[model samples]
Target chain A: MNSILSIREVSKFYGSYQALNAVSLEIPRNSIYGLLGPNGAGKTTLIRIINQITFPDQGQVFLDGEPLAPHHIAQIGYLPEERGLYKSMKVGEQALYLAQLKGLSRAEAKQQLKYWFEKLDIGNWWHKKVQELSKGMAQKVQFIVTVLHRPKLLIFDEPFSGFDPINAAMIKDQILELKEGGASIIFSTHRMESVEELCEHIGLIHRSNLILEGKLSAIKKIHKQNRYEIRWTPLNGTPAPEELLGRLPVIGPHYDAEDNTWDFTLELQDSEKGELLRYLSEHGNLASFRERIPSVNDIFIQTVQKQESHA
Target chain B: MHKLGLIIRREYLAKVRNKSFVIMTFLSPILLVGMIVLIAYLTKVNDNEKRLVAVLNESPFFKTDFESKRGISFVPLHGIGLETAKDSVLDMGYYGLLYLPQRASLEGVTEDAFLYTKDAPNTLVLETLEGIFEDRLREYRLQQLGVSSEEYARVRMGYEINTATFSGQRSAKGINEFKAVVGGAFGYLIMMFIIIYGGFVMRSVIEEKTTRIIEVIISSVRPFQLMLGKIIGTSLAGVTQFLIWIFSASLLMIAVMLFLDIDPAILMQRPGPGGLEASLAQSALSGDDTSQLLVEEFLKIPMGLLVGCFLIYFVLGYLIYSSIYAAIGAAVDNETDTQQFIFPIIMPLMLAIYVGFFSVFSNPHGPIAVAFSIFPLTSPIVMLMRLPGGVGEGGVPLWQLLASIALLLVTFLAIVWLAAKIYRVGILMYGKKPTYRELYKWLKY
Candidate 1:
């Protein structure tokens, strides 16, 4: 896959504390990349560096395979976690100002802003001060400005924060729409569920280091335990034969008294699905057979907990 | 540079469009002119109050000496003692009573003469009474010297030495004081503008920092650009407001003059022949043409040079001080924390005004005035104070003005460089209020 942003062994230090220690990341073009970390895991540090709000003490950042320069700021959009608009400024005026700062012409900025305002149904709020808007409405204005320039790379740090669920879903849909239009997105959040729903690729940083990274499916596969669940009802009111159960690679066998069925979780141990299916069929009438894959939340918790114990 | 322009435009619009800014811009000039008019009117009314004095004279030497003038009237009390005269004056609501004792000789007539009033007598009344007796005593002394009253009167006419410098420049008396006043006014304006507009810039920086919009702005433009843009934009707004004030104030003055049916030339006239000794002496020197001389003296002032220097110094002073204010705004999280930082920035400006008044008035070329005028921090104010003294031939030397400008420019650049660093780091920092040490550390970064 082609990469739009590549951070090569970037390290940042704040005073005596190291914020990012030799952390490298490659964000693929036209894809949603999730940056997941606990609080103080250097997630904000790396994001700020990507936006050039601050610089790295070591290493380099590249955008579109070119070394990042000030002019490249026009191609990037950032919605910081702690976002705000000038409270006393008129909504439309403030929006136009920000858009112009992003290298848009007055005519283009006004035209694009008109389109977004109408699309968002906020057409009548042009002359109102930003302080008059509700938090959700203000967030909508902020979102419009962030995406107004049609930047190639969009960095959203906690974009959904301070939004009602309905608005959050709206922003999520907008983000997806932008991604569909060939914009690469960096979605940084601790919400694993949102990550699972949006991100195709993810990088997990722990204690200033990138500990796990890859395609979401591949990463899950690598962390998978090869566990399967099988439910069966004994035939002729008899339990499965002891010899058959012993021959199969089984770990825990549980019985459901209410359903009068036997549930067994087994380790496949490199065995084929066909072999497991055949063994289940011969033992008893197969009720249900499924592989148990870990959710992103589960993977995140396990990875972080394991790392903590090791430390 | 384009982004900087955008930032400046935004800042300018934000300030100029504020309701309070517009109100104050127009209101201040009216208020200032109104205050001047009120004070002048009250003084005229006070001077018009009539006072009645009753004189009880027992001496036959001077019965016709007492006379009534514009605001003071004297009445003679016959066959009444001093106490009776005082009581009658009080009962009749007279302003005061003047008693002349029948002394054997006129040698101690002034010392023995007395004036009594219900309250403190007006000093002008007393001075007038004393002048009558003094003239009588001088005539008596001149008669004793065998000089005739007419000859004595000719000799007693006030004499004023015409003064002219070696450079053949003749200065009217009190011209130096007038120039000092004009220079002080310019210096005062610079001080006031720096404080007012510098506060504007500081508050603006604080507002941006507090609202957290600075993060979004800095991401697009450098911190230096933002700071410079704010200073320049706010300054332009200030200049706009000042221009409007000048236009409105002129209109208001014209309206007032027409309403009161007063001549504009009379407004420009020097103080009338009243309480001022200088004007009285001037009238004694040239009875009717003192006002003409005053007009000529005013014309002699190099107003063009004074105004040009004022603009240059005003701009340079504002840039230097406002940059410091911006840095302070960035360093503190709130206005309250700014107190510790603000005093140091304003100390030199305050000191310049105070020192400029004393040294620049007494001797413009004094060591203190020259030092403060040359120093970039106080030059904007002190230099204007010294400007009226006129250097080289008759005005501020071109080299001194140029040197002051060059020093201000160099200092402004250096300060802006340091302030930009503090602003960059401090704008994003929250919660913790920084100390001087931390600011120094930011400079290193």
Candidate 2:
């Protein structure tokens, strides 16, 4: 698949302060790409550049193999972090206006809005003012507007914010539905759970540089700790688990005295599952066992912390 | 083109639906008409305070029961001492009192010598007494000359000057002065609005930038298009509001006609000296003759010219000032920060208004008014006001006004360029206020 959005060595500067430092990344077509970072880590700056809100000092951006131009703006939909809304405007009225700005005709906008409103069960809100809506409800309106014109690429910054879990789930499903229909997405958020649940690819930005990025599963596999957690009967605490403990380094070996269950974390010195399994079977009764794969949240925090301490 | 149409439609709908717009349009006419009626009612209520003064003829000359217009009545009194007179009048609760000297010594008495009340006597009573004294003095003088007052009146010589201003050209005279002042005043009002509302547009842009909404919109629309769309949209809204105002004013006039004695047709129909009929007559007779003192010449401004100049100035001046306003808006984050820039824009407009009032009076072709109006920065308003005066004494030369318009256009373009530079950078800025150096660096970017 073609890279729906590609940033090459993009460096953005505000006066002498560098907002993004030669950051380069690729978002493949039809993927839920998570742009993960701490605050002030240049994620917003990169997003802004891709949206064409501001120009970068040294970079070229390509959208689906075409050089990004003014005309191409219609092909990209954006939801800014601050929530671009005219407060005095009525809800459906502004939605139609913005939809037209995004290149939809009035009739088309109304038709699409009708479908979205019914789908979200907010059809009654059409005549109401946006200011009267609760923050979560307004977010629904904003989210609908973000995807209304159905641009080939959609960029959402903290899209799930100000939403209840039910609405969040609804919007999440919609986002996935968008991706399935071949729309590329750049989802920026501090909530790592969103990245874990929704994103198929992830990029870690720290201090204005792309520290890490890859397919979600591939990145996790690369950072895999080769550790496992096992809960088993310890043979009445007679140190009968030596045969299991022998094959691997016992990072954590503890026993719940009341439950009479033994728990231990082991790291494989080498990728030899046969040896580890054989040792476990010989020494302890295998109650449960599972590999401890690093989560995107853990990796994000670890990556940021590593860079901070290293710098 | 489609986007512009969309913007226009949105702006029109939003403005027409705005309660502020509706209320302002209807409320202004009500307030204006209500104020006129309120004034009339207040005046009528104050018309009933006639002073009832008591006069005793101890002087043996002046008459009692004298009348003084509708606001003063004198009552007869029996001879009384000064102290008794004062106490009786004060106790009686009269508006005021006046005492005259006896007929023998009245010659020695001065107009200021009369005294009775603690405060100044009622003006109506004083005028009546003054008239009596003057009549008596005149009769005494006529007796000394051994001539009757009727004979003296027959011998008086008086002549009135019938001067009419005409130099085979346009001329200003008499009530034309008032008309000129009024025309200037109305033109000044229109000018002030363009400046005020145009500045509002600029401030709105800066506000949205400060809030960061401009950033999201800018992604799909260029800054120039956004700025242009907003300006055009807002201007159309202004005109729309103005039209609504005119409509409401007519409706109010109709309401006043139907419900009250006030005639709406009085304004519409020509009546008496100051009527539009007289104005038309004055100009129609001055064919090929510019020195006509006719009210018609004073009203000679073609409606086309009036509207043309107004539209030209309204749009051109608004664009010019709005650009500077946008620049100021982009430079500052909040309204407080705008104080530094507001004065420059406001002062020139005010100065133009003042200059316009004096344009037709002292020097219709004076350097000050001409200069102000011919300068595109101020011309849109001042020029429109002076156009009724026939381009001024020298009548503003066509080239001069056109040049001003051209300069205004260039200035408008330049200001927008600079404002856009600031806006492109300013929208994403927050927390710390930008310094002059930082703002300057943004232009470099």
Best by lDDT: 1
What DockQ, on C-alphas, does every prediction get?
0.63, 0.45
Candidate 2 residues B1-445, lDDT tens each?
Answer: 7776776576556656778777887788888778766665554444556667766556655553255545566765677866687788889997656666555654544343364666766554565666666655666577688988677655432322244445454354443454446457556756667675676677667657654567667776776676666677777777777777778777776687578765333343332232223334544434433344454665665557666777767776777676667666767778777776678788878777777766644565578866886676667666766665544344567776677678777877777788778766766676556666777888877
Give every collision pair in model 2: B168-B290, B168-B291, B169-B290, B169-B291, B170-B290, B170-B291, B279-B296, B283-B296, B391-B395, B391-B396
* lDDT to native, each model: 0.84, 0.73
Error of 2 at A191 (Å): 1.2
- Candidate 1 residue B406 Cα shift, in angstroms, is 2.0
lDDT at position B338, candidate 1: 92
Q: Write the per-residue lDDT of candidate 1 for residues B1-445, one digit (tens) a residue.
A: 8888898888898999999998998899899779757665655555567789998888766778777875678898899888888888999999999888888777766668889999888777877777777778888888998999899868766666566667886656666657778888998988887888889999999998888788777777778889999999998998898888889888887888678654555434453323334434655656444446666767776788889889888887898888899999998878999999999988999999888877777777767877888899999998888787665766566787788889998998899888888888888788888989888987754
Residue lDDT tens for model 2, A214-235: 9999999888888888787755
What is the TM-score of model 2 when looking only at chain B? 0.76
Q: Which regions of candidate 1 deviate over 4 angstroms?
A: A229-256, A261-268, A272-277, A285-287, A305-311, B78-84, B107-111, B145-148, B172-174, B261-304, B391-399
Give lDDT: candidate 2, residue B406. Answer: 81
Count steric clashes of candidate 2: 10
